[model samples]
Target: MMAGRGTSRRQLLKLTGAAAVASAMPFSAGSAVAGERRHGLSVFGDLKYSADFTHFDYANPDAPKGGKFIFRAPSWGFNQNIQTFNSFNSFILKGDAPPRMELCFDTLMVRALDEPDAMYGLLAESVEIEDDGSTYIFNLRPEARFHDGSKVTAQDVAFSLILLKAEGHPQVRLPLKELLDTEVLDEYRVAVRFTGNHTRQLPLLVAGLPIFSKRYYTAYDFKQSTLTPPLSSGGYKVGKHAVGRYVEYHKVSDYWAKDLPVLVGQSNFEVIRIEFFRESQIAFEAFKKGNITYHEEFSSKTWATEYNFPAVEDGRVILKEFPDDRPSGAQGWFFNTRLEKFSDPRVRRAIGYAFDFEWANKSLFYGLYKRSQSFFQNSVLMAEGQPPADELALLEPFRGRVPDEVFGEAYLQPVSDESGFDRTLLRQASQLLREAGYTRDGSILVGPDGQPLEFEFLSNSKGFERITLPYIKNLERLGIKANFRLVDPAQYQSRLNDFDFDVTSRRFAINPTLANNDRDLWVSHAGEVKGGNNLAGIKDPVVDALVDKALNAITREDMNVAARALDRVLRSGHYWVPQWYKPVHSVALWDMFGYSNEPPHYDFPVESLWWFDQDKAQKIGKGG
Candidate 1:
């Protein structure tokens, strides 16, 4: 997770997991009747909202739509070191782009935040799948139009798929490779065919992709990184942007799908402005001064001690925490196993023992967080205690290949007393390092070639410095030269893309309903791909096999079993020094916004569904 509003790039990629599982079931013969179509689709269940249904159950269908709704960027709470963006092209692999660029484009289908794995039609009015589940046809609504008032044709849909597969980010291109071909049946209808052995989720993933305008790109270069905003069809268009300072979006008053069932009572703001700051402290100051209207705080120290400004004291600003029902995904110090020093599992496990999470949670975090024990924390997908019969069965074939402990008990992080120095854990870590070919000369641990056992802990966030400083002290106790290096956001991103770090912090978001996107995080091929999200540089064959089983799982029970197996193996490998997570979102804003009483089950789609309260805005003298 990145730190402030809207979906980050990591969140967008993780959301595809639901689509992957949704496509697991093959369509039946009766479902393929001629002219048959449905308004909504789900992976392994019936649609939550029927075709004749109005707006989603959680939506305020009659909510007034006016006033400005300002928020900040890099929505993840702790890692808020993002500075400036140079490109308007978010889908490509070139340059850093502004957050929330997806707001400008609409997908064929829009996900209902309230549902676990359901998508309703947006551009397409109805969709039909072949009996074999290999082919899907979407009937686009004739009312759909681009920002330029040009009709969104089936050709545009087909071209978007082809273009994204060829030139989009690796996360976009890898899954799209399963798409055999796409055909424009007519001006308003398109068919997508899947290759053999494709996961059921591929079709829904394809449908939920950001649909670009074929005509717009035809007149411009899609591969280059530029500041020129492309034409979009979503509820908002690019209003004003100052390269890296700020970007503003103006609501499309005559938006094509404003009244559609999936879009009803949403996109309430007339203007949505995103302001960027290089420092998290400065952004917080701006929020306190009313320059930024909405902010979701991530730092525990800030959340615990801050919010004492006059606005908060006088009840002008509202501070609230919303409960989240989804998995508390993994965030930790990821080891780059591509390096020879980190290749051994023993070395990774030894390094993991050096971090003192208990002290950090108590002293640094103000006791507001729980230790993240699983990749899928706070979710049922987590493997608990010992490996179950099913997980054991899955690991049976790779007995000698994997850690023997994986078969007996689930992996647990080393716990320590609140005191930063734990001699017991340090001794244990030293023993593990010794077994991995490191010998201590006096206080320094040396590798097989007489090189010092050292690695750089790379980060961009100044906020993380406090947390890493304490951990670095523990690493030093083990005779490990752990150096913390802070770089600019652009340089940090480039280093991550090129896998140029020995250790780095990353938060891996996981969906309750898993998807093939997990492969991009764990598979061997993904680790080899440049710009991929395999931050740990994992490339184990057994892990790859488990990922296949999880993605191809035909039933919920089977999916859980496979996911647990994968989690167990991953934990056993000790690829990350697990961090802590809070199950609720800590948010603070001016009391000028109104939202549904119920938060979405999976995500906090605050900007999309929350409306500007005209009365409240007027009271604050910031009326739109």
Candidate 2:
């Protein structure tokens, strides 16, 4: 019943969930002046670790790493797909790239998962910001080198940013719209200039972008989808890979930044491998037979009933739950508002009434999930109860254009009686359709243009058929012709990119400090972009303005106020049929991996954080 989750490291920089009150002040000019060298950049306030720190507190410098870890990708970000891949050029919008492709490339700085939004220098040693806040000078580490041993220079850094803005995927290109230019100051230093009107977090966004070797791309076409791995400068290098079957990333023994404070205990596997299965059942079977070493169980039914295998009995397998402290961002069936049939808010609201989340949680989900009510579900950024005085004051400008409910109480989804069929909610749905100018034409709900109100739910996995089919059945009672159309992985992604579907589902991750690029999900222009995240085709001026206001807030308190206001407006739109969420990470793993036991509050990058345990491996009879 769940959808693809994003595991992109960039996902962390852009994620927004619960905001933590900063103990320190927001960014100030005292340490930000042009020649002062600070080791890290926090969007707000001071760095948690001093410049002289050795490693991130969450990482284990003493953790051992020398085993091959193969698992199915639970989530991915950007143009990455967990099922299949057709390109090595993950930055572009043309093809499907493998999850974890970002592992092969290093950014100027890397964000810490433990913090809300603090990034430490990786390729760059330290950054100096101009008083105007539009200019940033990054002092690169001289020791940083590409996998091929070429020095990572300022020209490459400048080239990478400019190239991404011009031709990268829309997600990568979204925040770069503020870039004025990137200038090469020296062999190991670069200057990036942004438009004066850019958001405060835009500078950090620029620094987190992946740096490419100018010499390598100069010889290859950066826009084309190819199987040949591009030249990168990250901790791991692309190893053996089958086109769409699997990919292996080998740890670089001589990686220049291996001893850097930011990466001391991360990327622990000697070889990290990802296995692709077009079907979930097949993927689970592979995990049961030991082809996959780690599995994040998404199905509550599977977790409840399917763990009595011989391995589990013998203690060779361990079932664990990791606490998800961050906000579970938006997850639901988003309507394509580009089409005239779905353009009306009333009609969209009517469709949402047909989904009985309580029945689904009992009959299908085993009562392990909660009905998702807000786009910022489980976060303080979510709007709840009534609009508070602060939020109402900020939202006062858009009074006429937005619904009155937004000013009254934050909209909550209608509750069903858990009877699988709620006649009262269905009657309300019928009334909404009639008000929106839809008429019942003897078993078919016809729209204003006299066309039947029919839309197909596009899907790639058949696992959701049970859930979607029942929803479709409910829609049928309302005289709405709905269908669940399953397509292949590549075609599903293609249809989504082109905005060709009527309805589709997705789960977005939000961190305390939101990703500046998340603006794509609500901005007016991104809705028209060929491959952007505005899947519901949201192009409202209020949403666009609210996105800017939220991202531009300098402090956590201000950000939460703005975000809550934005949430109220989005919920009122009925852009998505809100789904369900669980606050725990249900995972099953082989008894050979070791971690800090307590995962970070903001992120869960198990591949990088957990290491191979030799003693544990021997105990489980999985010794290499």
Candidate 3:
């Protein structure tokens, strides 16, 4: 469930001039406008929303559809045909791809109208849940096909599931594990049956799984599919590749589903290309030098002051910012429960008290981040204020799981410095440390072992490292010796898999379904021994029992009860020292592209209106 990518925070300052001209945003179109004329536009939206999004309307007005688009990602590799262990960028491509990927691929179901609820058919002609929600039947569009002439069959669907389940990323397998059976009724029909009662959000599981050719894959070694992508059935086919540098995809001129409602308003570009950059800073330089189409800003200083391009002033490089309620993907510190120092629930809650998020956001991120209180941010499910009648029905069961005070107003004792570090918070942290059997001397916490109760915090990104160091001072005051250690991607992965680190920072995306999360990250079974996503190495019988209740809830009421019960237990365990999340994605791109005035609730789709305007590209390059 954990993930990472790059973007800058200070986008408002860059967009101050452009917001002056836009007005009266329109509602998203219900379907794509076929036979639309081509007009070149280029766009950039953040990755979270892009995962399952394939419709062009979500991106922009479909236009200028005859040339190749070169997308630049910071990806390094890919997982075979499975969804697991692919490059970071490939991870997003599972359900959703970039502008090009969205244009190229389609899904059977998609998120409904920005609601974190259920899904609607995109490629599947119809889907019916039957037999008390234990069975699902999908009828695909009769004309769906890969770039080759072979017709898509129910066998392909079955093969995709078996292959993905066998080899895809662990997160990809979480939702489908309960899939007891999948039957190819006919060439155009498939039936999926779960182990028990199902969530309405079940179809969201099909977001990025394009049917693979069983014939082609059977002829080659499946494990090596990443290096040699099997003939795809999506919008674009592999055109060229320079290995680790870049990969190019050419649009299938006669793609069978091009005119389908699922693809409307998206896929304006005829070809898609992505150049991989080893360093993000180097990628930014490429964008400035016209080597890439856009740059997503995540740093406060860069957003406020970096876009000094003359094109920006002349409306050539337009920066766009919007307020939002969408989750920015929770990014913060996570503790390894496998480490004995943090085994006590009180210790984890005490650490949460030490984080000065308000100050961190204001001073470090220019107020671009919001403090997070729940795993699900900004959503109705988040446990906020006092537990309401509805919430209490769910939370009451796990009363002792979390602190009773957390259920009360005085739950998390406020740190002395609400905005920044305060000596008072330091003293409070020391007090908690003392209660936990640690003696503080000066700034070092001495444990029973006669050594400082400290461990190394590892991160791969410089940006995260910047935000992490501030808390070390607070830990020092509490007698805990905290060290900031930056590691490479390879070493980070090795350490995480080995459960070698005491703590680290990570963010996981939630797709409205709490069940998938339970299987992937929370269940005691997911801990290290299972080689699952139980990154925190926590194991508890109560949590395991709750996960079972959650998975088998047969009614809506039962589901909610299960959801809240599981949520309370997980939060109480304090597996992750949950941190703040940003609501809106701040994007800056050249003004050649046109998007709806309304901000996308889930993720901004850029395949619709964005096209490569050669004139604009040239003009901007000339500093015109």
Candidate 4:
């Protein structure tokens, strides 16, 4: 199970934006009253910068910010930790914090990455909406301070949304369980309240959370985990760090919404840093010894055999690619299904016919990935071939509660024949594990309570033990027993926030607009909520009412037909073996910096949109 906080929702609202909002909703309640007051917001259309737009046309704001950008954190967010960390209180999951700690606070809105679901305000300078959408209010920005210049009030945004919904971190308290209360209506206004069974993307996920500092967590303990650096206000803070080998952040020369228009040219690195490496070939040999300076790559056999090095023969490393226009989301191998030997969907489609992914993409991924067939992959809300009549009118009331091959077709995976082990797809994966009661008891596979089918894959990266030891030798030729384990990045996020394990490997970026972090990935009470992103425990109530009918649709073609009928009932619940995605991003960097143009087709957040080039950092001597 390989991972990196390839995570989203930290999955820390990764790259902090999911383009779009306002498909006509703006302040209303009962027969819809209350209107005016907005700066920006989008659900999927109508809002590509207006309301006195100053910055963001993919932010350049006259580029050239400062120096030191650094890299290696290809992704991370809330409960962060890319490979090492020990709390600076990343909004509490108790310890192992680090990765871009939402760049030290500030959030009553911020997100526009060239709009797809816009969001404008910074420390709220506007916002109104009311009841029918379950109230909101915001206002703030009386010079909103906070990295100790104090005053960021509305009683510190109603004490950081009432202590992150009473002690945050289940990736900030599971979509703030429909957040029902915050109020402080004075010191520069506030209000919030929700629970009208929230989720029309809960007011830009409560305007991108984070605020805090109600007098520095009223003298500590936002559910413990501390290394002290609490109070901040944005555009970076929390300088020198080392616990897991690198951290920084710095910037903020008087941050306070640094020229907000959804933060002008964005956190332009006056030292961003990050680094962390616990493996991915020791962070690609510290980006081939340049000690990391914006890598990204996520290995396709070390980007088709070790990027040639010697800084790519003198150009001092460039490699690039970029194009990732968002939504390559769900990378796979999930299956924890809150165990009972993975409660049969024909034993998770007979363990996805022992995964060959075309002989692991031609002998370990150098054909450079493609396989991931939609948890909304490369988007248009991904559920292709069949079911079209507005996704069969949202799957005609869950037609006999799901899986008639999720209304035929639309669940592909299982092509194999590159024969890493395909004996007729392992005899149709051992006759669907002997019609889901499993057998071969003479050698090992047992189950049906006679116990032997064994588990454990867990991982914190032994780079997927050469891709899980050839899919545990095709599940030991179907006699089962698996293995792998690996552990370490703090017990692999404390055993994926204690759902413990029976298989893992994650990727989850999933953004293109269906926010409220798609209820931490296909809800069912956020798969029993302890530090979410629903790592396949799932639960289902018709995949929780087609993910609340695609997070309360309202057009974007009815949220892509309730997200293609909730991605054909989560790819007909084989709950993932999926994996492989590319659309572009590979990166490599260190030829200094400078971007301000491409990227931002809904985020490529290269250390908050690149910069610092001092003449390409003095011709790659990596200048100041």
Alpha-carbon lDDT, every model: 0.80, 0.85, 0.55, 0.77
Residues 275-306 of candidate 4: C-alpha lDDT, one tens digit per residue: 78788788888778888877777778887788
Q: Which stretches of candidate 3 lie over 4 Å from their true place?
A: 1-62, 67-106, 112-118, 197-200, 203-208, 410-420, 441-443, 513-519, 529-531, 540-570, 607-609, 613-624
Candidate 1 Cα outliers beyond 4 Å, as residue runs: 1-35, 74-81
Worst 10 residues of 3 by lDDT: 7-16
Residue 207's C-alpha lDDT in candidate 4? 84
Please give the lDDT score at residue 404 for candidate 2. Answer: 92
* lDDT agreement of model 4 with the native: 0.77
**Model 2, 262: alpha-carbon shift in Å?**
0.5
TM-score list, all predictions? 0.95, 0.96, 0.80, 0.35
- Model 2 — which ten-residue stretch has the worst lDDT? 15-24
Clash totals, every prediction: 4, 6, 34, 18
Candidate number of the best TM-score: 2
- Per-residue lDDT tens digits of candidate 3, residues 448-530? 55677877788766666666777776666566667888876555655765667888886655434344544556666567533
lDDT of 1 by residue, 1-624 (tens): 223332242224431343344445465443344457878776664567888888987778988888777767645311122478888788877887877777788889988877766788999998888747788899999999999999998999999999988988877787787888899999999998887557756676788888888988999888888788888898898888887788888899899999998888888888888888888889899999999999888888888898898999988898998897778777888999999889888988888887888888888888998888888889888998888788898788889988888887788888897788788888898899989899988879898879888899998888888888888888888888888899988889789878999999877777677765656888888887777878888888888788877777666688889899989899988888888888888889899999966787887778788999889988987775
Which has the better lDDT: candidate 2, or candidate 3?
2
Name the candidate that leads on lDDT: 2
Error of 3 at 279 (Å): 3.4
The sequence of per-residue lDDT tens digits that candidate 2 reaches over residues 1-624 is 566575343522352122222211234554376667778888765678888989999999998878988998887877788889888888887889888888889998988778877889998899888745777899999998999999999999999999999988888887788889988888888999887767767788888888999999999999899989889999898899998899999999999999999999888899999999899889999999989999998887788889889999988999999998888878899999999998999999999999999999999998999989987899889888888899998788889989998998889999999987799999999999999999998999988899999999988888888899889999999999999999998898899899999999877776677666778888889899988888999988888777777877777788899999999999999999989888989989999999877898877888988999989999988887
